[model samples]
Target: MQYQAVVRKFGPAAEAVEIERAALPVLRRDQVRVRLLARSINPSDIITISGAYAGRTTLPFIPGFEAFGVVEACGEDVYGLAPGTRVLPVRGAGGWQEYKHTDPSWCLRVPDGLSDFEAATSYVNPMTAWLMLHKKIGLRPGMRIAVNAAASSIGSILIGLANAVGVEPVAIVRSEESRARLSGSLEAVIVDRADSDLATGLAGRHGLDAVLDCVGGAHASILAAALKPGGHFVHYGLLSGQSIPPSFWSSHPDIAFSFFHLREWVHSEAMENVQRAYAEVAAQIAAKIIATEVREVFPLEKIRLALQSTLPFRTGGKVLLA
Candidate 1:
């Protein structure tokens, strides 16, 4: 069968992406054939298109991070999965396509009561939020935690999860608009760019217990300093493309630093652990606690414009290939 997908070509402007027709992959033993419904644009997806993510994908690759689909066919050995079952197959780049054949081991049963959009977006961001808080840091109730880029998808999930567990979240955003947008979820919102008096923002307040940082640049040190002694700092992303400043270690000798990569979590955690994470994420999606907030949806034919329009710094929410 012919299928549609976005493909990246190599050149001086190698970052350019294009949509094309391709043959649907055939199913193999231990694999399932999926007809993709929707896929969300992620920062890692953009970096791969720009040829920076891992620098490992050969030229002319498909570009997608996550997708939700219906199983059209399954290998003989696969159990508990069959035709017409909705599932989310964990794959690297090919999820943007119309159909794919992936290992059945990677397909997680999506909650039946969720929309395609919600199922698609829930796997990555929500799972990351769950793993970071519950597994990576082991945050307890009544502890004070902070998050950078509070308006981001994962950051919002962190806030919701923290509040659900009775933990106070100190959300930091670079713009006033972000603070306004996220005002409902966070206990305290600070404008990172305008406020140099960050200590004053936490006045008459207890010390921070942890911090979830995505903008790993000069601000890493600033965020680290705000933490109480023995507080944990987890760095996940480097949207600013800046290295961690040296001062973070020198100025905060007592604060502990840790890195939380979703990729690493997926690889290191046992299959049961991963399944539990996905289950919690699926439940949140069903409850609308973790909603799929799509800023824009682009057809396969408009792949180039979609990528350009939703570059990380410009997009407000997750962009999807619909």
Candidate 2:
């Protein structure tokens, strides 16, 4: 038997979820059964839980987007992957349950040295940061990139990756306090949004090569203004709850826009490419080239409280359900 947090109806994720129990189903020849150890609550998880993706989502869905677990059992055909291996299970309702059954193709093996929380939280932020930097922007040494929401987990990751390769990063945060949270050693330009002329000032600087933004709406427009002609603007998250202004388009036609949805990318990308990407991200984490943070870990039974801790606009570190 397994316990899971189920969403029978969409509304508020915390209020809508109810704990339920079910027995394990028959395992197929290519499937593996993972004993879930931890799951991370992300904005994407909250969006999926709120019926934002109801058209594609099934009812009574499990809401975890990423989780870390141990391979408890594997079917006869699932060779090379043995029992007791730790992993990040994928390709199902998700990992809010006591166990997850997945085919081997999309599941990622957790490398040594990462805690359960780091592996559980790795897929969303770390992978997205890696893809946007590598595949989308093709970032290289000496390029200038601006990151909005610079205090965030993924934001920190982008800065670290940039620092590692000699690319210059411009970090934009909503306040001076948030700016203080960043390390002075990273050799990046730090901007506090409270300064009224800041956005225009960024536009006038030597000019940015790209902007990696998760905060959409008017703020996205502000960030885009800072990009030089033909600069790439990647929009990934919508924390503002408002759409990017039409003025954003009418105002800056030379700036290219891309919306990055991690789930969609994973579903369509070749499994081999997915594995290779995960391997790169895992190596980055293992070597401390980047870091993942967990502010708290709650037991699986505390589903409601854990969801509340991850609500929008409030930030510190990731919260996990175990």
Measured by TM-score, the strongest candidate is: 2
Please give, for residues 204-248, the per-residue lDDT of candidate 2 as tens digits. Answer: 554678999887877777778778899999999876678898888
TM-score of each: 0.91, 0.94
lDDT of each: 0.76, 0.82
What's the CA RMSD for each of the models? 2.3, 1.9
Worst 10 residues of 1 by lDDT: 5-14
Runs of candidate 1 with Cα error greater than 4 angstroms are 4-15, 194-206
Q: How do the residues 16-97 of candidate 1 rate in per-residue lDDT, one tens digit apiece? A: 6666777666578888898888888787776666656546788677767688899999888888778998888875667778
**Pairs of colliding residues, candidate 1:** none
The clash tally of candidate 2 reads 0
Which of the numbered candidates is closest to the native, going by highest lDDT? 2
> Between which residue pairs do clashes occur in model 2?
none
